[model samples]
Target: MRTIEVFADVLCPFTHVGLRTLVDRRGRYGLTEPRLRIRAWPLELINDGPLDPHHIAAEIAALRGSVRPDLFAGFSVDAFPGTSMAAFALTAAADRTGDPALVEDVGMALRNAVFEEGLDIGRPEIVEPIAVRFGLEPLDVEATSAAVRADWEEGRTRGVIGSPHFFAEDGSGWFCPSLAISRDDVGNFVVAWKHGTEAFIDRVFG
Candidate 1:
């Protein structure tokens, strides 16, 4: 199987939608050569601080009210993770198993716990069960952290524009392809389908 690497933050609302779209539409296109390799793009490391829950809550509100009413229905600001590094490391550990399905499944499960189940994935209590269910071994913390940092560095070299940046092994790339983000006149964020997005999705799964 070909690999399509996606560098994304686990807690990003946008990444949640982008990954969900990929999983939801993959079968529709009747193609599956490119298995998604979910990589880490921890915004906290890039920004040098934990993301503000209030800011994320605002984005979730806009996303839910605009184009994704069916998603994030259980989001809770209080349950938001304080840091995504550990979660990223968890996904990185999954990637190390050399199973694309496990990597993708673990990444999506982490996001689902956060966005739909109102779980604090930063906590072991929340993330551990998901790892165990996927048959993941105990994570090698040092190795996983290094893997995540390597992905961040690679994303920088590849010029990842933001979370959910997809890079095909063939060298084609797209950033946040699932939705178009814009601001309303009053400065509230609005989202819509990007023009020509379906063609790209076809290319991805086809």
Candidate 2:
């Protein structure tokens, strides 16, 4: 089994796009089974001052019409809360449960709440319902919040200063969302493990 550590900020449009792309291709990429893990590494989208949700939403809207634009176009960014706080919240969520999938779900839900449903994720009360929807216990909110703060500090120590960073099991990492890995470079390495491993390897590494 190989794990892909995805260091991303929920407030980042590129992270949203990259995640949607990965989710869309998960099965096609032969990562639909237990052999793959998607871990989150928190990153801050805004600094110094409060982020305007409306402006962020508009930027997300502009990203629509590009490849997979519909993945985020219909959302209203203005309805969501600030970016920095949301990132903190997600980190807290991941820490409380120790479930990477839950962390990813929380991140996705936060994005949807802010961009698609025009909800405020920065508010603990607002984010609680979404967390419940993912089967997380509402009481865990406090733990999740604390985790966010700790993760932020850890992220900085790791030199992760941006969103959509990829850390592969082989120690290969990518900081840019636009990075594309050639199969030949790590052909013998397992990209995914499933019934279609042979075919996936052939298509990617052949």
Candidates' TM-scores?
0.93, 0.68
The reply for model 2, stretches above 4 Å from the true place, is 33-46, 83-87, 138-146, 179-206
Question: What is the C-alpha lDDT profile of model 1 across 53-107, one tens digit per residue?
Answer: 9889888888888777899978989989998866776787788889887788888
**Segments of candidate 1 deviating more than 4 angstroms:** 30-33, 138-141
Best by lDDT: 1
Per-model CA lDDT versus the true structure = 0.84, 0.54
Error (Å) of candidate 1 at residue 174 is: 0.7
Poorest 10 consecutive residues by lDDT, candidate 1: 26-35
Tens-digit lDDT track of model 2 for 4-32:
56666666666776666556566576675
The window of 10 residues in a row where model 2 has the poorest summed lDDT is: 188-197
| Clash list (residue pairs), candidate 2 | 75-115, 76-115, 92-144, 92-148
